[model samples]
Target: MLSFILRRLLSGVVLVVTISVIAFLLLYAGGGDIARRLLGEDASPATVAQKASELGLDQPLAVQFGTWASGVFQGDFGTSWFTSQPVSDAILSRLAVTLSLVLGATVLIAVVSVALGVLAATRRGWIDGLVQVVSLLGTAIPAFLIALGLVIVFAINLGWFKPTGFVQLTDSFSGWLSSITLPVIALSLGGIAGVSQQIRGSMLDALRQDYVRTLQSRGLNRRTVVMQHVLRNAAGPGLAVLGVHFVGLLGGAVIIEQIFAIPGMGQVAVTATSQGDIPLVMGLVIATAILVVILNLFVDLAQGWLNPKVRLS
Candidate 1:
């Protein structure tokens, strides 16, 4: 198991490096006057040229890439052209907001999705049918639309919560939670549907297995047969889907965040791209890619743990 984890960690390192290089090169390929764009209309041509040179824009492509990559390795994602702050620091400052929303939504979705799926699979009646319909509806609707609808109903019409702006949790927990609720709900809708579907399929398959039938024939109660035996077998698929979706929640909340006006990493990446903040955007991409790789590796480890026969070592 240790060896397997180490191997995956090595792979993750390679993946992050590859992703960072690609993101940096793609941002650089646009060949715009980054310094001029950052300086805006007030800067003269000579000033822009001087600033660009100072920023090392005149260096050869390979040299610039090496410099950027080295800085990244040293945990320096460069200074943001707009903010003149270290990219890492800028991103980390907003990390709490993004993590709070993502983690809260994830926990809620996992509980709701798993329960609905298990119930629906075990019952196979009206309860199951109703859940399936809801899941289907959820899948069909986009997150941004859900976010808008939620804001309209809960904030604009009902006046239950403020419609926009983010507050730090330490400053005011209630205010922070209120600001995050709509966005979390919006982001979780599609995930809920996806997880439910994956769980349902896996549970149904588990139920039809020979071991499940053996457990049923042994006079085990329905609850035990389903929860203990079936759920254990079914969890593999659900975990796989959950792993992929978990990574997505971090970077995929762009639309939902924008709609709810909650500042997060997704919002940061969007703003960075628009302003051509190459370093910030590239850093965000690298961070997101690394997250995905790590989650996937963890999923594999989990699978091996759940079924010892899989032999991770």
Candidate 2:
């Protein structure tokens, strides 16, 4: 297990470096005058040139990348081109909001998907049909549309949740929950559908296995056989789906955050991209890559733990 973890971590390091390099190059190569964007449209050519030189935009591509990479290695993500604030500071400020939404949606997905999937697999009648219908609609609907619908229904019609803006957890736990609930639900709908389908399929396969019947023949109750034997075996694949879905949720949160007017890393990313803020965008890209790699590592570890037959090495 230790060796497997070390290998995963090493791979994660390599992935982050590769992603960072690609992101930097792409943003750099994309046509844009960063200095002019920072200075303004009315700035003279000479002024723009001076600004670019001062910002090291005049440096060769390799030199620029090397400088940025060196700073990254030292835990500095560089200052935002527009904001002049450290990129790390800006990201860290919004990280909590994004994390709250993602983590809440993840927990919701895990509980709802597993329960609905298991129930559908075990019941195999109207209950299963209902779950299937819900899953179909969930996967079919776009998350932003879901966000709009939720805002209209819960925030406008029911007055249960705030339609926009976020509250920090430190300020008020209940406020934070109420503020994030709609966005979390919007982000979770698709993830729930995908994960539940994966779980249902995996559970069904596990139940059909010979050991399930053997356990039943030994007089193990249906619940015991299903919960203790079937579910455990089914969990590995379900977890894999969940992990992928969770990574996607981070990307999806950008639109949801925008629609809901929530200040988060997603919102920051959108703004940075539009304004061609290279440093901020690079920071977001690296942060996202790290997050994805970390999630994959955890999923791999969880799968190995659940299924001892699975070899990590």
Candidate 3:
């Protein structure tokens, strides 16, 4: 187990390096100079050169990448062009908002999706039809559309929930929950649909296995057979997929944050891009890429743990 973990960690380091190199080249190679973009079209050449040199943008690409990557090891994500603050600090400051949304949506997706999936699978006639219809509606509706509808009905018409903004949990628990409700619902809708569909298929497949028949022949109640034998076996793949979804929840927050105006990493990225904040953009891209790679590694490890067959291989 230790050896496996060490191997994965080494691979993760290599992946992060590759991601950093690619991000650096992409940002440096694209369009106008970042300093020029920030300083405006009418800026003097000397001013541009000074700014570029200050940010080390005039350095050779390899040297610049090396400097940036080295700083990353020390938790410095360079300085934001907009605020002149460390990009790492900016991202970390907003990390809580994104984490709250991701965690809330994840819990909702897991509970609701698995419950509906299992119930539908066990009662495969009318119940299955109803669940499928609901899941289809979730999948069919665009996230922006869902956010809009939620705002219109819940925030404007009924005034039951706030349409936008975040309230820190330390400030007010009620306000925090109220502010997150819409974004969480929007984020969870697609995940719920996907997870439910997958779970339904998994459970059905588990039911067809020989062990399930043996349990049934022993006269075990349907509930017992499902909760004990079927759910355990069927959950291996679903759980694995859940890890991937958790990673996606972070990336997909971009749209949800924009619609709701939540100050998270997604919002940071959007703000940076609009302002042509190259440092912030590059930082976010690298951070997000590292997040994805780490989450995928975790998923693989978890799958191997849950299924001994994977570990053996």
Candidate 4:
């Protein structure tokens, strides 16, 4: 298990480095005049050149990357070219909001998916038919549309939740929950559809295995055989789907956050990318890469724990 974890960690390091380098080169390759944009359209050519030189834009790409990479190694992501805020501070401040939505949605997706999938796979009657219909609707509907309908139904029409804006958990737990409820629901719908399907398939397959019948023949009750053995074996694949969906949730949160007016990385990432704020954007890219690696590590660990074959492999 330790060796498996170590291998994953090493691979994660390589993945982060590769993502950073590719993002850095692509942003620079665009050849956008960052200094000129910073200075404004009316700035004289000479002044723009001076600004570029001062910002080290006059140096070769390798030198620029080396300097930035060195700073990253020292825990400094540098300042936002536009905001002048430290990249770490800028990103970290907004990260909580995005994380709140993503993580909350993830939990919802996992629990609901498992329940619906288990029901569908085990009983497979009208309940199974209902799960199938619900899954289809969820997948067919867009998240933004769901978000809008939620706002209209719950916020504007019913007055249950606030239509927009996020509340910090530090300020008020209830307020935070109320504010995020709608967005989380919208963000989780598609994930629930996809993951529930995966879970159902995995569960059905596990139930059909010869070992399951063998275990049942050994005097194990239905619940005991299903819960202890069948569910455990099915968990690995469902978990893999959930892990991938978590990444999608992060991305989906961008549009949801924009709609909800949440002050999360969604806003920061959109603005930074559009404005060509390399420092801020690079910080975001690196942050996202780290997030993916961390999630994958967790998924791998969970899989290894659930199935020894995974760890051995």
True-vs-predicted CA distance for residue 296, candidate 3, Å: 3.2
**Preferred candidate (TM-score higher): 3 or 4:** 4
lDDT of 1 at 220: 95
For model 1, the superposed segments whose C-alpha errors exceed 4 Å read: 39-45, 310-313
**TM-score against native, each model:** 0.93, 0.97, 0.93, 0.98
Number of the top TM-score candidate: 4
Per-residue error for 218 in candidate 3, Å, reads 3.3
The C-alpha lDDT values of all candidates are 0.84, 0.92, 0.85, 0.93
Residue-level lDDT of model 4, residues 152-256, one tens digit each, is: 999999999989888899999999999999999999999999999999999999999999989888899988988888989998989999999998998999999
Report residue 136 deviation for candidate 3 (angstroms). Answer: 1.1
For candidate 2, give the lDDT of residue 94.
96
Task: Look at candidate 2 and give me any clashing residue pairs.
Answer: none
Candidate structures ordered by TM-score, highest first: 4, 2, 3, 1
lDDT of 2 by residue, 91-153 (tens): 999998999999899999999999999999999999999999999999999999999999999
lDDT: worst 10-residue window of model 2 = 304-313
- Model 2 misplaced stretches (Cα beyond 4 Å): none
- Comparing 1 with 3 on TM-score, the higher-scoring candidate is 3
